[model samples]
Target: MTAVEPRTPADPATTTELAPAAAPWWTTAVVYQVYPRSFADSDGDGIGDLGGVRAKLDHLAELGVDAIWLSPVYPSPQHDNGYDIRDYQDIDPVFGSLEEFDALLAEAHERGIKIVMDLVVNHTSDEHPWFVESRSSTDNPKRDWYWWRQPGAAGAEPNGWGSAFSGPAWTLDETTGEYYLHLFAKQQPDLNWENPEVRQAVYSMMNWWLDRGVDGFRMDVINFIAKQLDLVSGPAAASDEGSPMGAQIHDYLQEMHREVFAGRTGAHLTVGEMPGVSIDDAVLFTDAARAEVDMIFQFEHVSLDQGVHKFDPLPRNLVALKRSLARWQEGLAETGWNSLYLNNHDQPRLVSRFGNDTEFRYESATLWALVLHLHRGTPYIYQGEEIGMTNVRFEGIEDYRDIESLNHYREAVEQFDQSPASVLAGVHAMGRDNARTPMQWDASAHAGFTTGTPWIAANPNFPEINVAADRAAERSVFRFYQQLIALRHDDPVVALGDFELLEPEHEKLYAFTRTLDDRVLLVLANASDTPLTLQGEWVPDDISGAELLLGNYAGDGAAALRPWEARLYRL
Candidate 1:
């Protein structure tokens, strides 16, 4: 593959006054994620709504994020927390009416913040009208819209594939005497993308949203849209390595682009949430020439610390993490793009999972922010992450609200014969509920997230880690994030530089450089609690005259880095 040249600063007079339309806005923009159910609640309903998000637009605007990626707010039964959509074009009553959503979108655009809706097309709620019609009878016209397979001998599941949440992937529809496929929970029945009508319906829905003024879409489990129809059994060890979806994913993506996005005009950002995607696959998925998508959210870095199952986690190793991230930076350098993130709605808090959340919480949070924002990708900041929110330590299964966590607990303790305490420990460490806890707004009760009871319990540490406290402090994690966002905007190298990893084998320190022509930005981070001196080989020759752009600790030029300390230098 030929390399795309790095974008360099040009003379103002020589360049056009307006940016070329061919260049997508997301290439240099930062996106902030808001899990609506936890961001803020209005009407004292103990649940967040579009009104709540509208009320909090100022907070996002002040954060300097270019766009806001909202988790699903579509109509649903609240099964799978709105990911199981019953309606594509309407807002759920639990959230708000379409009028409220319109107001929110209008208000967000007024503040110069782009709104990116979560596009969940891999499946729809089993109660969806389409699915309802499909299951009404064997001869229903919409029956082929979803995967409906007859059971094998002894009325067993059609295949041996397991649901991501738990149990067999196929659920029997008593009315039709056939099993329908659901990769996730049974509430979310997989859509049959092989059916041209199903693909057209999805594209039509997308066009409706784009017509409604949504800036772009964050496609959910998009790669899973295409599945093998052979109904073959998967590996007993539980892996999706050779899933049939891989065979026709690109074709479907290209078709989607042509049908829904081909002639669309705007700074639209399209990102596919792809799991088990390789670097080579990502390049094809995101290459401009392919016209598939603007970018993709890859899982390589996040999967490094996982054990047998996602709930089971291994110890964090900075060397492995650095190598994983650097590989992506290099892989997507010329032909593709990367979506940089440490945590999202379905992942644990970054501070708790990968950094120190206790003694050096502030340092670790700020250091990690630098590492991610300085990378050559669009950085996505999850809600509450800017203020250093730590993972929740729910005492029992009852305290958790996520279906995935609940299902894991039941299966681990009942079928696997694992102790409740053991499963609870893993759930506390890696459960999605950790990231779903209400956003910490202030030190007030419920972290000022709601006046009524919260849908899920707030983290006990909210009082100390809330936004109000961070704003009042002289130096805080929120402020560090603000600085990083500013740096990315004011500095071109952050968005367009070529990346080179330094000391790839170093376990205690993560060092890298981003260069665009003569401008060089060197980032050195101490990934451990103990202080250590910078290794000579890791030091660049131009460091002596480089200006200190930012640092967690006060220093003019420090040879030794403090615990979890990080410094950014511009040469």
Candidate 2:
């Protein structure tokens, strides 16, 4: 296959004059994320499948979501959950068949909800035929398909760079006497995008899916796909600007757009998960004229409380959080777009991480929902998030299911000389397993996620935090989400308004205004356990008799906001 040259996108900083005829359909849409392994199990096989997702479509429809982003369900060895894909075009036996997935697509389309598939092309499982052929011999025909290097001096690793999961990124194959690079787990070898054959093959696979009626793709670790061909050592290897990396990534994406999605119909959504991406780069990636992607998932706000290492978390800082999100809002105000989300499959539950999840669970959950939904972007709600799901507290490391958490525990305890108790404490606070637990549907065995044993245990608090109780309660987070979704659909200002962050330096209050033409929407929330009175300057001049469109509290309080109180007003 001959590769086509792509047209470069104009610089976003100077391209503000370029504008589209109208906003896209997704600006006002809300997406729901479904982690298939934990969502529901229709076959009672201790795992969720395509059938389970099809059965739960009504729940998503009732919640008023416009789309469902399903995490990877491709065939895999289960080394890194479903991300280490062995076959790109087939479904895993554990997750049902291709026919089952087709049924799901047709059913979701019937209800006016689009289905977005998780695209994990950055790496492939070691068991994949491409990788297996490449590793068979030293001079195999497909040896250049993946990054393989000879051992360094004294038979050490190719470089000193560490894997995202832990240990050196290069794994040695005894048979070939060469090392293959894997940014994540050793079971997942990174594909060499430098090879034109590799790039064309990936594009072919993507086009196959698009032709099959899938809506779009949520690309995983997309920024890391472009690598330094020199095989440089040290931390700088992950830097943004390089020969085949950084800015060059856009070229590959542009070519992919022309090849796979040039004439695609439907309101397809494309979001790239780009870590360590700066705002300027994000602007270029999301600019409409770029044709690279619709939006990118930036990690600035989520990394505010993270220490040097991800597991070593620091205390949350409200002031820093506000500043980070504000910067993104202003950066993309003119030329680009944003993807609003608090937590996803790779992180802990948002209610437990950023909100009080205990004494004020309902209050804090609803408050966060109100603040995030009203932002000028497409918001994504993870499964179990609408019902105020809390994090799980497993007693031991053995109870965990994520490969990252298990590897960190071993290294921290044995190599770093840390105590098992201390490592377990960190895992409890920031482990991926916290987000991988079975979804809490009702107060039954295994939270009604599975009739048989669950792949991982459900949160012990499911008895009170399950969907059944929230639907019946007078004040429920699920119902609050419904109202927010409806508001976005009914009001144009919520989606097209210009964002102006107010009181960004304030510690306990998160206030912002959305202005479109003559309409102004104000969102105020007390992100703390204690009550707070709005400072005089923070209160707008048109607040005398503003209509309260939505609020978490029962009755309108006079001046002070109650604990975790959030209100949306139209002035």
- Which candidate tops TM-score? 1
> What is the C-alpha lDDT profile of model 2 across 338-357, one tens digit per residue?
99999899988999999999
Q: TM-score of predicted model 2?
A: 0.94
RMSD of model 2 against the true structure: 7.2
TM-score of each: 0.95, 0.94
Tens-digit lDDT track of model 1 for 77-122? 9889999999999998989998998899998887778889999999
Candidate 1 residue spans exceeding 4 A from truth: 1-23, 231-244
Report lDDT (Cα) of residue 363, candidate 1: 90
- Pairs of colliding residues, candidate 2: none
Off by over 4 Å in 2: 1-21, 231-245
